[model samples]
Structure formats: C-alpha cells, structure tokens
Target: MSDTAHEDPELIQLLTPEGELREHPDYPLDLSHEEMRGLYRDLVLVRRIDTEAVALQRVGELGLWASLLGQEAAQVGSGRALRSNDMAFPSYRDHGVAWCRGVDHKALLALYRGVTNGGWDPAEHGFHLYTIVIGTQALHATGYAMGIQRDGAVGEDGSAVITYFGDGATSQGDTNEAFNYAAVNNAPVVFFCQNNQWAISEPLERQSRVPIYRRAAGFGFPGVRLDGNDVFASLAVTRSALQHAREGQGPTLIEAFTYRMGAHTTNDDPTRYRVSAELEEWRLKDPIARLHAFLTREGIADEAFLKGVEAEAEELGESVRRDCRELPEPDPLDIFHEVYAEPHVHIDRQRAEFADYLASFEDAGAEGGR
Candidate 1:
C-alpha cells in the first residue's frame, strides 16, 4: 500500500457496492426477517413519495422540493435506529427520515406548498420541523440533547437524539459549535452527516482537504464513515452510534458516503454545474437496486415478492399524490395563532383589525349584490 493510502482516514463500511454483506465486529444487528422487510418497505415508500413530491412541484402545486432521491438508505437507516422517545433535528431535505419518524406525507407538503413553515408539531413526532438555515438544526439538536441530560433521559433505556445535516453544513460555524457543545457536555446525540458528494454545485473536495469523519477526533468524539448506498452498512453504523450515545458515551459523528442523483431542489438546474458522466457513475451504485439484488440472490426474496413490493410502492405513490393534492391550504388566520405562548394586546388588536378588513370586503360584496 502507498504511504498516502495508509494516511487516509478510516471508513467503517460493512456492505459493498456489489451487494455483499460484510460483518462488523462492533456493530451488528439482530434483525428479524420481519424487521428487515419493514426497513425495505420504508425505503420503497419514501422514494415513491419523493418522486410524487417532485412531480407535484413540476405541476406548480409546490413551490419547491428538496429531493431525497439518492440518500434514502442513509436517512432511513439512521432514522429507524432511534427509539420512539428520542428526538430528531432535520434539515429541509429529510422527508425520508421524517417518514420513518411516523410523520404523515401531507404534513411535509406545507413548507414546499407555501402554506406554512411547518404544519405538524415537532414534539408530537419526536422530529423537529425542517430547518432551512444550514447548520442551525445541529445546534438545536445539541441543545436538546443537553436538555435531555438535565432531565435524566440518558441512562438505562433513556433516549438519544439524532441530527441530520449535509456536507456543506460542516463548514458552518453553528455546526462546529454544536460539535464542541455536544462533546464537552457529553450530550447524548448523534450527528449524521450524509456526505452525498456535493453540496449543491460544489464538489466534496471543495469542502475540505481531510475526510469529514476525521473532524470528530478534533471534537473529542469517535466518528465513522459508511457506504450510504449500502442500507445494511448504514443501519448497522447508525444503530451502533445511537446505542453508544444512549449508553452515556457522548456524541458520535456518522458520515454516510453517498451521492446526490438529483438536483438540490426543483428550482436548481444541476446540469449547469455538474457533468452527466459523474451522475452516470453513481447510478451504478443505486442503493435500492443493490439491496434488491442482495435479497433476491440470497433467496431471501424472489420475483413474486419483488413484484408485490413494486405494486405496494406504486399504491403508496398514488396515495401520496392524492393526499398531497387534497391537503387544505392553511387558513390565513393561522399566522397569528401560534406565534407566542401568551397573547399580547398588540397582536390581538392586529388580528382583530385584519379580520375587520376581511369583513369590510365581504360587506362591500353584499352591497354590490343588493
């Protein structure tokens, strides 16, 4: 091996691009057949919904969509690793993870549809609303983890939180601060970074000279890198990280090596910045296809089962489209409803005035009819 190769950072990969499963000494899942199928089901449905969301954006029903097309395994595996009581801080592109947290398909459309910031309550689903500002959610996730520690929620079956961010976010000050805080305080949180090769048009090399996983050492924590396209690897690595945090071992950094096969959002024209050759290269490593091949080849799944899964995926796509289209646009009055815990006189007066203004329009229409 070359000296440079030896100097390269360590990556903890347990599954290969060729669909072969490798064993990891530290991280192993005692997954039942049903649990394995359930994980696959989540991946299938999440992708279907993602496709429908993109279509909705094209049809003008949505203002924009942050596509999760190529990062399904990374999101789903990490999301499923969390316990029911654990919290998640997600960025705008985490619809796949949101699905694993039991968030409804319709609930995610509010932000993209320009109806609300976030329609669902974060506390209800144990997942925070989609944070648009890059790296902000990391700090929030870290702070929440600190709160969990204060509340004595970090021992003997206590929950641990996971926060999702992208490669570009690693350069942000807030993200660095989050790491410092989590590491210093021994906060029970997992920082899951999906290193999907690009931060929009910017390539991964432009972000840092050293591999991102190495940053954890500087923060006084352990970090691991896994093949994000390999669901089994991602699942195992994330489960281990979360388990470590829950056991009071402090924060862990998981860098999932994947590729972004789609534009950053519907508004982006990635073709302008990226070459087709690179996209084609990653296409061969498609996460879902690798898993399907592994299952079929191992005799754990067959053509009939695969066909059934396809049918179910199609049904899920149709249902998501139907429900997304049927979603009621938020009432305009909702703007004033949840801004503050206690009502202020000034806000109450402004709300009343706004209602009066709308009433005046109605009254004018009545007079015109008369």
Candidate 2:
C-alpha cells in the first residue's frame, strides 16, 4: 500500500468477511440483539424487493430498472445508520435506502414505469427524489445540509446529510464541487460512494489511480474504506460517520469496497466485459449469507428464524411484483404540472399546443369535448 493510503484516517470496522467480530477504535456500535436482528431483517426484505423488481422488468412491466443485488449491505447498513431527522439524497439504484426511509415500494416502481417523475414528496420521508443524473444529488445534499446549519435545526451536536453516487459518478465535476462546498463551508454531510467495481463497462481502475477513500483527504476531510460485503462493517462505519457529521465535524467520505454481482441493469450484460471468475469470487462473500452464518454461529439467531425471514421475503417479493404490475399509467396532462410555479405565456402556449396534439389523436367528433 502507498504511504498516502496508510496516512489517511478511517473509521474502525467491527466484522471481517470471515464473519468474525473485530474491534475498531474510532467506531463501535452499541447495538442490542434486537437491533442487530432488525438490521438483518431490513437487508433481507429489501433484497427480496430488489429481486422482484428485476423480475418485473423481465416480464415487461418496467421501462428500465437498476438492481441493488450485491449492494444490500451497503444500502441497508448505511440507511439504518441514519436518524429519522437526518435527510438523504440517493441515486435511482438506492431503492434499499428508500425502503429504509419509509418509502413505499410501489412509489419506486413509478419511476421505472415512466408514470411519474417521482411520486413521493421529499419533505415527507427525508428522502429526495431518485436522481438518474449521477452525482447531482451530492450538491443537493450539501445545500440541504447548509440549510440545516442555517435553520438552527442542527443542535450543538450537529445534523447530518448522506448522499449516494456510483463509481462512475466520482469522475463528474459536480461531485468534486460538492466535496469543496461541503469541506469549505463545514457542512454536516456524508458523501457515501458505492464503488461497485464497474461503472457500467468501465472498471474502477479507469476511474481512480488510488483508492477512492484517499480522495477525501485532498478535499480536507476524513475518509474510510469498509468491507462493503460485511453488513456489520458498513453499518458501524456509516453510523460513526453520521455521528461525526452531526457533531459539527464536517463531511466524511465512505468508499464502500463492493462489487456489482449482477448486470448493471437489465439492459446490460456483464459477460461482454468481465470474466466469470471475478463474479464467482464475490459470490462467496454474499453479505446476507455471511451475516446469517454469523448470527447462527454466535447464537444470536437460528434456523427457525432464518426460515421465517425467508418466508417473509417471499411474501414481500410477491407484493412488489403484484403492485408493480398494477401501477397506473401516468395522466398525459401531468407532463406540464410541475415545470413552473407560475404560468408564462410561452409555457401556456406550449401546453395548449400539446393538448391540441393529444386531441388530434381522438376522433374528429370527440376531439371538441376534450
């Protein structure tokens, strides 16, 4: 490892891939047995939802969908670490985090179905709309943190913000700007980058010469790399980072070292660019399976509980598939609804022209009624 990599500070992780609990000096979670099980449950349920959504796409209900397949731990761990008072900004692939924030699974399907821009209100769940344009949410999260600071909503301990982006997004200028703004202004936000090894077909080597966490120090903040496959490690690191931000310590960067176990999306094919050996290696580190092993071996959980959880997962998957299949097509007039708060002549004219175009599709006699 480079001296630079060693010199940069990072949080402690509680568990390794072997499913053994390790100690971290900087970050230790004070979790109860129930709390641990709850975290496990969240990961399991979200994974099922993720699987069902992909199946929905395959069956022709969705326009496009992004899979969170191997990323269950990264999303669920970080999502559970957040406080209800804290806000989150996520990319479209963060359905797991959205689930953690109380977003209805059906609401997420609305985006893939092209029925609505995004159906949920951010204020209601502290989850911003799903951003397809990568890295833009980082800025929005930073700005929201600034608002929290200004509003005196941040207590003496400080309030926190977390934003999600992919490995490919790290190269965007907006991401760098977000880091600068968060660092200089001392905004209380955590920039959580899920480096799933591949940015579509591009590999991590193409995006960075050094580890992603090392980039944090360049912007005058702390950063850490967690064993993203270990739910305990991800949760421990994120919980501590959120605490750091809330305590007015400014922003921290978390580069979750994970892999994309499946295709980037249903539209993608991993076989085109990568080898099967890599996928086979990562499969051995399946986050949920590792945690279940840990729980059973440690006497924290057992086979009956595991079977029950699996049954619940199946039920959740069925619900997701059914709801997604029945989602309504968006109303045609909704296209012009939120574009402007106040009306303008050009917008009004354009809307009128659009309405006329739609009316043209109707029979000549029926068009007048519309």
Candidate 3:
C-alpha cells in the first residue's frame, strides 16, 4: 500500500493540519468546548508520561521503554470512548490508553523497571496487562468477545471489547486467526490497528500489498481508515465501531493511519533505517500541535488554559521520575507467587527446592563469617 494512505480521499478526518474542522457523513463528532479542552489536556499529559519514561530508560532507571511519542491522539481518543464495562487488550506501548482507563501512571514504570511482570490487576481497570507478544492480544480479545456473545451480552447496554495492536501485527498468523474467528462468530469486538508507518524500521510496504483496513473486507466485515493524528476522528470512529458491535453488528476494523516519530523502543535506533526528512515531515502534522492550534483558533481555550496544561505536564513528569526511582525492587521468590492461582504438586516441590538452595547459601555465609 502507498504510504500516502493518510491522504486518501476516503480516509475520515475531522480536523485538518491547519486546524480546520471537516464533516464526515458517517462519523460525526459533537463535542462541547470543555470536552475539546479535556482532549487537549489528555494529549499533553500522555506525551509527558511517554517522555518521562524515555528519560528514565536513558538514565538506566528503566530497562527499556516503548515511546508512544506521536500516537497520543490515537490512544487517548479511543481510550476515552470506552465505557466502564468495556474491556481493552493493549500492546506494550498503549500507556496513553492506560491513563484514560484510570490506571496509575507510575504503575507503568514498574514493568520497564523489571519490578513486575504486570503492574496492576487487569480486572481493576478493565484493561488487560500489556501483551508483549505481538498480535497475541488480538486472539485473546476475540476469545473474550466470543465469551460475551455466549453470555448473551449483545444489546444497547451490552459490553464490547477493543484490541489495540500495531501495523506489524497484521502479518502475524494470530491476528489473521482472530479476524477469522471474530467474523465467523460475529463477536462484539473492534480491531484497532495503529498503522504508524514504520513497524520498527520495516516500512508498511513490507507488511501488506494493500491498505491494512482493506484486509478486513476479505474477512467479511466493514473497515474504515481514519487520520490517526486527529483526535476528533479517532474518537468518533471508535465510538461508532463499538456501538455497532454492541448492537449485534459484529466486528469492525479501524486502521489508524499515523506515524511513529521516535524509535520503536529505547533499544532500537530509527536513525539507522529511516531518514531525517521523513521524521521532519511527520513533525509538521504533530497530533498535539494541531489540536492546540484548533483550540486557539476557535477561542475554545485561552493562553492561560494552555499554560496551565503545560504546568500540569511538568508536574506529572517530576512525579513519575520520583516515584519510579522510589519503587522497591521485588524479591526473587515473588516470581513463584504470581505463577498460578491454585497450588500444584510440581510447583510446590520446585518452590521448596529453591528455598532450600537459598538457605544453603545463607548458612555457608554465616559459617564463613564465624
């Protein structure tokens, strides 16, 4: 597919780069001034959290970090659209969604810090633990959606599930299987793919012959491509998709056409494969900047409000840095505690053996000191 998918005439876009608002026939956004301001706040704070995490990794505080530097709007917009009962299966980089789901931002740092496999209970926030294995969450989300259907949870107030993945995941067998399963079962699920141009240095050309959204048609469902940089577009399209699923309309595929402005993770360097010019081009379409422009041009927010948001972002950065450094390291034995809910003979015997081995080292140390 062409990299210019974002420029496709059929793509849904509510706000233009110049801060202009356009109307779409199907997905219409009706937001009050306060709601617009709130979206801007979410964009700013999400960016701050990402930046802070990146800084922590560079300083050796975190083992690694996945920077969601440019895709803040895609995450925050769709995340805020979800109802309390709705479940979200997210990739490792969807910290912006975690924020909207009421997850403590500091908890995110623990995973990169190697303090825990998962930071919080998935049930507590209706958000699953970040899945590191690419495209696996798509299958998990589909299975969960099928469960919803079996439970007869398909109505106006029924629940739905949204699975977040990247463009690279489209090539995985797991994702394709999920597409097939969801289509056959008519599961109440939305497949939200953040097509951020480069999937860790391999461009979109390597992943699909046609647009990612177009693949949904082969699976027997409706697909829509939207300007992922536009928060209004993301929110509007996601809300419509979820509603369709809840009303027994089956699955809808949403391809969010955006770009990743930073390295895929703290470990990889984009400078090696991608050119600086490409980065500069996407910078002009920065999600946060356009939204700020719209808010300013329409007089929906004053300079005072913008400045206040900046101040809040700075405070959030400071808080994350401090709390991340203060997090207590987990004990080695705690790994066994989280392995299973119920006890098994093999696990108990292994734990006992490990305990004895640790005790032997302590005994040796004591005798040597004496």
lDDT at 29, model 3: 87
* Ranking of models by lDDT: 3, 1, 2
Off by over 4 Å in 2: 1-12, 156-158, 341-349, 365-370
Of the candidates shown, which would achieve the greatest TM-score relative to the real structure?
3
| Tens digits of per-residue lDDT for model 2, 1-370 | 1221123344334655557777776667678888788878988998888888888899889988899999989999899888888899999899889999999999998888888865798888989998888799999999999989888777545568999999899999999999999999989999999889899999888889988888999999998898677677788889888888877889999988788898899999999999998888788778888887778779988778878888999888888888887888887878888677788888889889999988887867686687
- Candidate 3 regions exceeding 4 Å error are none
Per-residue error at 292 for model 2, in Å? 0.1
lDDT of 3 at 36: 95
> Model 2 — which ten-residue stretch has the worst lDDT?
1-10
The model with the greatest lDDT is 3
**lDDT (Cα, tens digit) per residue for candidate 1, span 28-116:** 76677667767777788899989999999999889899999989989998888878899999999998889988998888886788887
lDDT head-to-head 2 vs 3, winner:
3
Task: Order the numbered candidates by TM-score, best leading.
Answer: 3, 1, 2
CA lDDT, every model vs. true structure: 0.85, 0.85, 0.92
* Cα lDDT over the full model 2: 0.85
lDDT for predicted candidate 3 compared with the true structure = 0.92
